[model samples]
Target: MSVKPEPVSALFAGSFALATLSAPDGPQFPALVTPDARVTDLRVALADEALTVRGLLEDWAATLPRLRALAAEDGPRRPLAEFRVHAPVEPRQVFQSGANYRQHVIDLHVAHRAPDDDRPEEERRAEAAEIMDRRAAEDLPYVFIGLPSAITGPYDDVVLPAWAEKPDWELELAAVVGRPAYRVSVEEALEYVAGYTIANDLTDRATVFRRDMPQIGTDWLRSKNAPGFTPLGPWIVPAESIADPGDLRVTLKLNGETMQDESTKDMIFNVARMVSYASRTARLLPGDLVLTGSPAGNGMHWGRLLRDGDVMEGSVTGLGTQRTRCVAEDAS
Candidate 1:
């Protein structure tokens, strides 16, 4: 007989958010987080003890009703603070969209202009703006594959590689897929999204380009694939909970100062387009994330870069927050 799978969550409003959490030095399990910071262990509440966050996502449509019923009627639960929170879901693949924000790219063009190009600042800025307009009208998104091993918890420490001269943060809104999405259209893209979460797409700016082979272009592998480079979720806020992922505010604070504060409305390609564009090539499975690019005001834009002891706080509209401290690895 086919095994019945259950999800690790339930809700407060219409649905509850899912989380992967555990006690100190204990085995991780899926649980439903409440609005009051209490959580119900899905293992005890559901029929299958082996039910997991991923399994829940894999069968989202079937388990959704049960989730609602469970949410309305509470049972045994615990405080959220008593457990160590983890990345809400473990995905086999992660797709990242780059240079998708309108204003962010324009600022980068001005900031990283050629030394000899001494055109007036306004004239240069005007040129970049026109280029972005054209791209939005007719161009494919610049999407790249990110190593899932780079995933870490919301409160985890991000170890900055000693070799990295300029470490940067790109706080973005990540869409968590529920149904298997392959070659889905933009109109149907949101239908497959189960939830949304926060992601900081950290990059080693110094390693972005391969000096040895300029013609080969950007090197995302070396620039982004470090352990704990991508600090994901405190929890997965169900897509239904977020009325519009394309209109949320993506903000990041470095230490106590606000660094990146922009709206998803500023994106050249919205969440639906990004997810649809990515699925054109790859089969996005349950738990896989389609990371919508970050908004403006990156470290480079402010003439600042990540250093050891730097604490970053990032949050997306309804998806919750992630706080990761930068730790410089000792080369010697």
Candidate 2:
């Protein structure tokens, strides 16, 4: 029996915005994709030279269709593999969710409970579940800010600072905001999203807490904002393509071994709810990133802290994959 070849679909049908290095230690340009899956280098792809991916995201609704139409027309095309891909967009503001995954938070609570308090595991789990249920009912989402300077390309090398003894990985799905949102309702939240990308929110586990100030909570700046700490994106998959952001699978492999394997369905607060919660206090502008929390099976849970020469591959269904290699910070 003969099998039929799958029909070739338009490249923009599930389109992504990508950047490529134009020269060694030089400027990057928007990558133009063709209908046949080939990429073309063209200045016309971007109207403004000063506008980075962040600016493009502001007009994503109009920009996407234009690029798609351009791709359908004749143009100089190159093989997609020939170019180096950078993070899809440079976010002006980055909002990271903490303990938003049901299983992940429960795992953390159970693992960190005091040794003397030997409550039954089942009871502890039930209590954690109750807390999540309460939080969902109360409409609360824990969000923290991250610096944009820490952003790096998906395949960039992550330099583990010498002071950081326990570098860890948290793979997450990041929503890219297209419109300015302030106090948006949950029913209208997803409409403000331009697209989605993958971010590996690398953390220094040893520096997560404040040693001097026990009253203060997590020191996110010290723990999560090192240079190149956040390895983001192979591309931005337009939100329209993702029918349900909550149903996607988030997977990570450390040194070729499966580490984190879970679905966004496990999230305590879904994307819409999280976005709505974030906008309640902050003005979410175009190109701002809202990172939904990581799922269960982080490095802390597995006791497999990142080391020099270790590689981590993270992917979200349809969003694309990011592979980052770890290297020790050069003190010289």
Query: In model 2, which runs have C-alpha deviations exceeding 4 angstroms?
Result: 1-26, 34-37, 46-48
Tell me the deviation in Å of residue 224 in model 1. Answer: 0.3
TM-score of each: 0.93, 0.90
Q: Write the per-residue lDDT of candidate 1 for residues 134-232, one digit (tens) a residue.
A: 999999898999999999998888999988899999999999999999999999999999888889999988989999999999999999989989999
Clashing pairs in 1: 10-16, 11-16
**Poorly placed runs, candidate 1 (over 4 Å):** 1-15
Q: Residue 88, candidate 1: how far off, in angstroms? A: 0.6
lDDT of each: 0.87, 0.81
lDDT of 1: 0.87
Say which candidate scores most in lDDT. 1
